[model samples]
Target: MAFTGFGGSTSGTTDFTQELVSATGLAERDRPADLRVWPNPTPDGTFTIDAGEARILGLEVLDASGRLVRSLGALSAAPFTMELGGLGAGSYTVRLLTDRGPAVARLLRQ
Candidate 1:
């Protein structure tokens, strides 16, 4: 398990399984290069996703237990704001299904 935050590039194809494993890790170290989340530990459960150069095929939000909490489906926009105001405060995982592969990011709702 590996983890990373900020500073990565979506320059090549990535293995979905590996990306998922890296993203799900507890520490921040080895996530995909192209994915980024801002206003993390979001105050109102709202945040932005910026996938540089990578085409996003799908996006989903999962609870800490790894259960699907919200599915945004296929998105045409690259940089977009996601609203999680409906859910309670805690930890969440964001999975991005992209042309390169799947990227995962941990989120905290405050």
Candidate 2:
């Protein structure tokens, strides 16, 4: 995430607190990992999964308490999108079962 600020007409200062906070948060989340997921805290009933060069065998959505909510088998492509229409508002775990290993990510429903 990028932010721009307009210069002041006179001598002034720019508060870096907000920018620092935002940058830290973004950096912590957007790591160069093998897998990625997005649209977390989404209400659109959809989310994406990015499995880099891994053969995805299955996908599972688990509730916050570690209960299995849904399972999908045999994904044929990378960066696949899944629908979460029936899921209620809460935190969830999206597990991508690949041939190499399981890539886990967090998801939030709104």
Candidate 3:
């Protein structure tokens, strides 16, 4: 399957997938140019999502197995802080459904 990452490009290779990658592979590279995430390898169970001027439509947190962890339905802002303290330490995926499109990011809970 085709995958996008932080750099903004989808390679034909299966090096990545939409399931969520730590830092190397994020989504929205081919869509919204403003959606971003900080502190990829989060020391805590929280991270900030900044979508610039784009309005978020939805948000979801998924595990490596593609299981939905947390679902924040129908977002209505640009910048926000998502808390994942409920999730144990592991790799997770944060999907940002924005007006431009859906953006995926890799998250590491420590």
Highest lDDT against the true fold, candidate: 1
How many steric clashes between backbone atoms does each model show?
6, 0, 0
Lowest-sum lDDT 10-residue window in model 1: 14-23
Q: Which stretches of candidate 1 lie over 4 Å from their true place?
A: 1-33
Question: Using lDDT as the measure, what is the rank order of every candidate, best first?
Answer: 1, 2, 3
TM values, all candidates: 0.69, 0.66, 0.66
Q: What is the lDDT of candidate 3?
A: 0.77
lDDT of model 3 at residue 55?
80
Candidate 1 per-residue C-alpha lDDT over 16-90 given as tens digits, one digit per residue, 9 for 90 to 100: 332356345534433453889989889999899988877788899999999999988777886989999689999
Q: Rank the candidates by TM-score, best first.
A: 1, 3, 2
Q: Pick the candidate with the highest TM-score.
A: 1
lDDT (10s digit) by residue, model 2, range 9-42: 4557544322334645545434433678888778
Question: Which TM-score value belongs to model 2?
Answer: 0.66
List lDDT for all candidates, in order.
0.81, 0.78, 0.77
- Tens-place lDDT per residue, model 3, 1-110, is 33564343466444444544444444544457376887888888878888777788888999989999999977665578888876889999888877777778888988
